[model samples]
Target: MAKRGEALRAAHLRYAPRKTGSGALHCFVLDCSASMLARGQLALAKGLLIALFDRARGERVEVALICFGGARAELRFGPAVPRWWNERWIEPVGAGGGTPLEAGLARASQLLERAARRDPGRARHLWLFSDGRTTQFPARPAHADHVTVVDCEASALRLGRCRALAQAWDGACIDADAMLA
Candidate 1:
């Protein structure tokens, strides 16, 4: 059940006047870790990323990329279109060391927050790619309007941590195979 304020907001959005070309922002937080290399998950994710970039190129969406592994995270591209994105660029991304999923989410949150400040009405979506090997849990960032956690875990014994993370954020959760399908 929706609260009074939530219902009112939903009503407003439901009946609101349409605006042409209200662009959206897509923040992709990628996991580049040794675990992802199992079952060629990292390779599959890279392929998906390229496809996603191609789709974004056809639309009025701004895309950002954040890859986390080892002990830290870095924003390779952000707050703008990736004019140089291609297979060649995606090939060099290394996968090793710790998962650092928390650091990745934190960095993605920062980017989302900044984008929200610039355009509060613009749609902000977060796409997290991980196998959920980390032990850290972080609160969902408020700036992200929507979140989807794509679990890359391929082990026979699955922990379902990605689904747990999605539930915690009230977001969507899908495995890589499901997503690809």
Candidate 2:
């Protein structure tokens, strides 16, 4: 079963860019609110993040991570050399605290800005994984070339806000629950 899971994961890693364009620097903003601690959501989020990191490696896309919880945001991974991301380094995300979406987004924007300065040709994308239960929204940074929202909310009541935020930003919203299915 483990081997089969590895095989499936490997197969899923083969993602072709939808358009022939310059490579992008992808920054993932993850919400680590206490709510995420419900139902093994943190583990799932980490797995998805690792998978995305593998895809970024394959596509030569730079990657970074920003985690928000407890009224604070932190950059757990980098705008450093892209090779630094690995399973061991990314797997231990814990969930506790209030959702600080604004702070997370701001940190992500800073990372993206720095990456852009370091590599002007690379496109910038912000992929946010959240339950969207925050009291505040980050002002969308103009530097984000594209935004993708991964909604981890499973309950009907928890679903709408994330979707609404995604729509307001004119970005793509993916239901993480559906992906798990």
By TM-score, who's the top model here?
Answer: 1
TM-score of each: 0.86, 0.80
Candidate 1's TM-score: 0.86
Clashing pairs in 1: none
> Model 1, range 1-181, lDDT digits (tens) per residue?
3455464654454454555427899999999988998888899889888988888878858999999998889998766765657888989998999988878888998899888877778999999988887788889988889999988888999999999999999999988888787
Give the residue spans of candidate 1 off by over 4 A: 1-21
> Over the stretch 77-161, how does candidate 2's per-residue lDDT look in tens digits?
7754366466778767788989988889888878877776766667888999987777686667667889999988765466477
Report every candidate's CA lDDT: 0.86, 0.79
Candidate 2 Cα misplacement greater than 4 A, ranges: 1-22, 84-86
lDDT of 1: 0.86
Please state the error at residue 76 of candidate 1 in Å. Answer: 0.9
